[model samples]
Target: MKKSLVYLAVGMLIFTICLGSSLITNQAKAAEEYKISVVLKALNSDYWKSVKAGAEAAAEKYGVNLSVIGPNNETQVIQQINLLEDQLVKGVQGLVVAPLRPQAAKTVLEKAVSRDIAVITIDTDADFEGKTSFAGTGNFQAAEKAGKYFADILAGQGKVAIIRGAAGDYIHDQRVDGFMQGIEGTAVEVVSVQPADSSRGKAVNVMQNIIQSYPDVNAVYATNDEMALGAERALKSANQAGVKVMGFDGSPDALKSIRNGELTATVKQDSYGIGYTGVELMVKHLAGETVASEVPVPTFIIDQNNVDASIRDLTKAFSRDRLEVLFGEDVIAEVFAE
Candidate 1:
């Protein structure tokens, strides 16, 4: 009877030990699960609005927690850097950032790597050693498309002007470089290129000044939607005739302008796709899947020919909070609320 009692105690002890070990292992696995955080340059512009919608929608679908935040303006690099640090302190498992200033965020990014948080850059890539990958529109190629579109719209010959965003932004600079290269040796003469600081008011002033200087400038290509609109307003105000303006990024205003023919065309950047894909790649990388280090989303130039359908697509893309799942009206209605 004593031996039997001792044996029963030993069996119970072993079972308890095994059960505790299993529980610990499961806890560790659960702790490894990730929550993604997204940081954009700024809010307000339709470009970042679409991006935020994409990231949020993706988070809902993937069963992961997501947080999206950014500065009030893209020009405030220090504020963006501080925001990254704040997210890090909040214990984000992964990050997707459209960096305002690349060099400013380098140290924090390295810190994020040290904490084993996966990092994927979106929209703008900084020169740094810590990013896991980059996923966004290929600005260079998109710019080339814009340039060619300009030439084609003007029938490959005209005096053209350019309005650029920030001075140091990779995406904006690439657009300008690609435009210049694309127009090299072509009959279209690039009349003036100036930095508009991504401000509509600044763009208006710069464009108005340009029109005053070169009254015959036939085309204007602004690197972003806001600047483009400003240039258009200036041109119309000055009563500048035959000057077809093009902008980048499919902003809601840009679409409305397209409908009105005030803006000739724009290189569509799929901001929603950028946001969603950035999160998707970050999650995959965390899962130990090999994703491309650089993903260049495709772009298209929308002229009068494809403007109607393209504008419709742009609206759907913009209404990211309301995407209807294919063949499932119930889910679509439930998810979209419209």
Candidate 2:
């Protein structure tokens, strides 16, 4: 009976050891699940609202935890910085942001990286500071393309005005510079540069001022979609329908206007893909995969010809595959390549 008792004890010991090993393995696997956070400019704009939806969808599909935050506008640098500081305190696995200001956002990136959290920039460039990667429109190149698009639409001989959203923000600045560079030595003369503050009302007021200053203005470029639509309303209110308007950010309003032939063109940014690819890159960094240092998501110039087709086929509401079809695969691929 003593010998039988010894055998039973050994069996019990083996059972406990096996159970403990299984528990440790499960716990370690749980730790491997990646957690991430995404920051945007604001939810006030439909562009960012759709971006949040896409981020959530990607998170659900990938079995990852994602939390999103945004400031009231792209210029809200301090608020965005504070938001990042909070996320850092929470110890997220990765952080993705479209900086309110690239230089200002740099410090936050450095801080997050020092803590070993993967940092990725989306829809903006903060490369002067260290980051694992970035995915955004090649703002400079895209702006250049947009400028040329405007000049071409105007047939290269017309007075044009530029309505910029804000002055110091890198994204808007790069866009303005690109547009200027595109029209360099062209007959299209730049008559004005007005700050729209990215408000629809502000854009309308600025656009009206430009119209008053240059009634002969043949083309206009609003730095963002909302501003562009505002310019269109101003032109329409004055009974001026022939002035070609090119805006950035292919928001739903912009697309619809393009379909209606009001806004001449818009450089469509893949914001949804920005959110999704940003998350995917964060996942890759977390998974120990080698990723590019910068990703340049390309931009699309929308006009009447392609607007209806693109908008009509807006399927899945938000998906990377569908975004590629709407924006183009080269966009997000270029973003990751950086």
In candidate 2, what are the lDDT values of residues 114-202, reduced to their tens digit? Answer: 88888888888786445889888898899999988887877887888988977887888989999999888789898898888888888
Measured on C-alpha atoms, candidate 1 has an lDDT of 0.82
**Model 1: residues >4 Å from true position, as ranges?**
1-33, 315-338
**RMSD in Å for model 2:** 8.3
Clashes of each: 0, 7
For candidate 2, the lDDT comes to 0.81
